[model samples]
Target: MKTCILTTDTYLNHDTGQGHPERANRVTVIIDHLKKLKSKDLIWKKPTKFDLEYLAFAHDKNYLDNVKDSFPKQGLNFLDGDTIVSPGSKEATRDAVGSILTAIDGVMKKDFNNAFCAVRPPGHHAEKQKAMGFCVYNNIAVGAYYLLEKYNLKKVAIIDFDVHHGNGTQDIFYDNEKVLYISTHQYPYYPGTGKNSEKGKYNNVLNIPLPAGTTSEEYLDAYEYVLKKLKEFKPEFILFSAGFDAHEDDPLAQLKLKSEDFYNLTKRTIRAAQLSSKGKVVSILEGGYDLNALKESAEMHVNALLEF
Candidate 1:
């Protein structure tokens, strides 16, 4: 299998100051561990510069201009209470969006079978007009639009396994019939949006809200519902909002998933979507705080991607 890892060092400069869970070290640790693998099967690539018009596809024009003006020279600027940006964040945020777009191009051109983007300043929480939950431009959302507009793909499915609900991704595609957004996240949690009833306008959104202490068995059981939904949609392309914070070791969430569970989750998803998608899938980093668990869980997810 041709598997690529898309990333860049600009993430290291996206400083969030001291003690922030979404710090630069998060991606650093995962990249470091991945380097230890040193497998010839893995191709490392950097995010390519993309047209800013793609940003307008996922975010409001005014909001895009505001984000452009929000980057501070010396200090950090906060888009929301938690979403912080510094001088280097300008490039970091763009790269975050670029990472997914680049990976999509590589997959579409058959340069790689699939890819995992390990970029930072994680997106999935940024709505069309606002940033929240440490997310800026909703990178995956733009990638979905890229598939829709560039490849003219009619059906695109975004499966979010992040610990927190992808409130922004749902917000962006709630009314679009071409895309299906399904997420299994901890509910009654921060941002507090993912109710089982918040289906999209086209019924394209499926939010499976788990309790605070959901176990692996329970979570996987719920994931079966996600698989069922994917089977029905028969998407031509799939994007994973891959977050590892659901692990028991993560400090941010209460879910009790082990590292190996990610492998099972990813494998199940791939098998379910392969026939319709022709094995075209791209995954990007979202939320995973605990360094050790994040590293292990990411590797497991990639392992499945490779084997499948």
Candidate 2:
């Protein structure tokens, strides 16, 4: 059982314009760094072509139609103040979604034990009808729906370790009992949504909102609660909204997690849910700004996936 790395070159075309933190180079650095490892334990793969109806699993019909129409014919178009699209964004966005679906199919079919999608135009912030926070479509949400609808999965869990809260993911699964969405993020920060009190309708959502300047020790300590919750839920499948911007080097937020923290937390999460999930997991790129930090952290994350 190997770990798969799913990605495509289409992400290079989803231009965000100049000086944007969520640039195409984010995935470039990660893919470049991972390739340097030359690890035989990794199975490199490209995202397979998938049905466009899968997008509707996460987004509204009108919203999806609007997004399809919003892609520019030549230059750039803004989906929101921060979420931008270009001529190539049409392919990039669909490829981003396709990457996850392909990864999910691989894992479910045992072609790989797990996967990490190094993709741009990161999802997790796009809500049911609105695109925000450098996200156009909720990729992981659609993956969860695919698990339920396509694979007939009954218990699915999403762990979001991004610096900013995944308000969009929480919004989509708020009332859905079969899917559990947990997020640990710097609160009262950008987007400002991950309060501990914002549990979902069926109490399926858990938000561990930490204050800025939280250190590696403090963040890991808080992560124990996440593990405890996972143990209680005993999910059948697990998905990670892997984000590394919490690294101290990241200019995005003030959380002080080191690169190795991702490995430790991921190892713990995999170990904690081993019995229920059978080591079945799929991770997708979300947010990580500092190139060096993102590179180091994503490598550490993959190391954990390779190990377990």
Residue pairs in clash, model 2: none
Off by over 4 Å in 1: none
TM-score of each: 0.99, 0.99
Cα distance off (Å), candidate 2, residue 182 = 0.5
Clashes of 1: 0
Residue range 1-308, candidate 2, lDDT tens digits = 59999998999999999999999999999999999999998989999999899889889999999999999899889888989999999999888999999999999999999999999889999999999999998999999999999999999999999999999999999999999999999988989898999999999999999999999999999999999999999999999999999999998899999999999999999999999999999999999999999999999999999997
- TM-score, predicted candidate 1 vs. hidden true structure: 0.99
Per-residue lDDT of candidate 1, residues 114-164 (tens digit) = 999999898999999999999998999999999999999999999999999
Q: What shift in Å separates residue 160 of candidate 1 from its native position after superposition?
A: 0.3
Question: For every model in order, what is the number of clashing pairs?
Answer: 0, 0
